[model samples]
Target: MPAIEVTSLSKTFRTKRKAAGLGASLRSLVRPEFRTIEAVRGLSFEMEPGELLGFIGPNGAGKSTTIKILTGILFPSGGEAKVLGYVPWKQRRQLAYHIGTVFGQRPQLWYHLPAIDTLTLFGKIYELDDRQTKRRIAELAEAFEIEDLLETPVRKLSLGQRMRCEVAASLLHKPKLLLLDEPSIGLDVVAKQHIRDAIRTMAAQENVGVLLTSHDAGDLEALCKRVIIINHGQIVYQDKVSALKRSFLTSKLVEVRYAQQVGADFRIAGTETLKVAKERYGVKLRFDARITPVGKVMAALSAAGTLVDITISDPPLEEVIAAIYQKAENRE
Candidate 1:
């Protein structure tokens, strides 16, 4: 059976309309206008065990709503879903034992308590034995490099230090499924690498299925093989990361810095000048898949002038996503 399966799952939230003034706000207490907002509309997908999938979308795209349904924090209004052979909404109590969740915006640790105290609390809540809890704590602390932070109070630790403890706290139950929402948010380069490495190691050793949501494409590039892109509460694209890039992007961006001033004709054939500076210029050029490869980027710029330096950049994931949204808007 698939580790996670959803068929036309949907969620609609009823929002109350409140007026601006205090009189109107007080009046709302007597009677309120209700608006039904569909957060997730007819979404469906399946994932196998031990798979690492990236779920990404713009704000108001219903990414969080869908995750809430899959993790059993909220009920779907239509269709159905099965995660690990159990209906998530109906079997949340049972599912909690095997699924772990980490929310980047919220710390699971208690502020005044030491990091180890939070782990102990989680151990009791999950009903783990003393021996199992100790072993899991040791393993995760070592892997996450939070051994020093264990004795420090949660509120006193640095953001990166606290994040490490948070992740370690969530995994103390030995969950089979891990749900991470923006786990790398606000992390610096070195801290981001450490978190990504820890995630990769856990997924490999524990054989857990991970569903990660992040605004950072670098996180997806480092941890996930497959990605599901959502827009306006529906799936826009679902495919391998490599295939998504290859199929959606038709052009590459090249930035060049010249030794001296160059004429307008110095531009590449069939390329557009995105921007030009005193001694530097950026060009957008189409690549015919087989004709112009990455290796030829510097050489092509050399033909234009005495090239000082040249760099090739892939189209940003945001650009590809915007293109998809524009296509949908046009069709609509």
Candidate 2:
């Protein structure tokens, strides 16, 4: 069976409307105004065992709501859902043993206590025996490279170190499904890579399915093979990461630093000079990867001046997501 299955799942929230004026407020006291907001609309998807799926969307696009419903934190308004063969909302307690969750903004570790203490507490909560708990902790500490940070107080650890410990704690029970929301948020590049490597290793060895929600494109690119992107509470795109790039990634940005000064009039065919710092021997250029080969651009740059340093990168993921959203909006 698939690790997760959902058919037309939806959620609606009832909220009180604000009163505008004093008279309106007084009248509202007698009878309050209300509004119904649809947070998730007819969402359906499936994840297989050991699959790394990227569940992504813009702010308030129902990403968190969908995760909450799947994890049984909130009940859905409509539709059928099953995770690991259990209805999350109906069998939450039973399902808890098979799944793990980590919300980057919310720390599950006790602030004043060492992370090792929290891990022990979690082991007890999960009903692991004493020997089993110690063995699991040692394995996780090694996997996450947090062996040195285990005894450090949660408050004293750096954001990256704490995050590593948090992830390790979640895995102590050897859950079959892991839900990670912004796991790499507020982490440096090196720290992000560490989390990614650990997650990759765990998923491979444990055969644990992962549903990762992150705004960092690097995380998605490095970890997820398939992605489901939602906007306006509906899926706008779902496909392989490579396919998404091929369809939406049309341009490349190149930055170069020359060893010597270059003229302001420096130009290359099929490329646009975005910025030119003549005195500093720095230039930023952009070209359509679909039209002009990156090899040609590199050759042009090399011929222009003695190259000191060069970097090439795709456009930010936000830009790609915006383009997809705009297209979806236009179609509407």
Roughly what TM-score does model 2 have, to 2 decimal places? 0.90
Q: Write the per-residue lDDT of candidate 1 for residues 81-126, one digit (tens) a residue.
A: 9998889999998998998999898789999999999898899999
- List all candidate RMSDs to the true structure: 2.5, 2.3
- Candidate 2 lDDT, tens digit per residue, 1-332? 99999999999999988768899888878999999999999999999878999988777889888988999999999998999999999999999999999999898999999999999999899999999999999999999999999998999999999999999999999999999988998999999999999999998899889999876778888889999998777999999999999888889999999988888877889999999984859998999988999998899889988999999998987789788889988998
* Model 2 error, position 104 (Å): 1.5
- List where candidate 2 sits over 4 angstroms from the true fold: 20-24, 257-261, 295-310
Clashes of each: 0, 0
- Give residue 159's lDDT in candidate 1 (0 to 100): 83
Which candidate number has the best lDDT?
Answer: 2
For model 1, give the 10-residue run with minimal summed lDDT.
Answer: 280-289
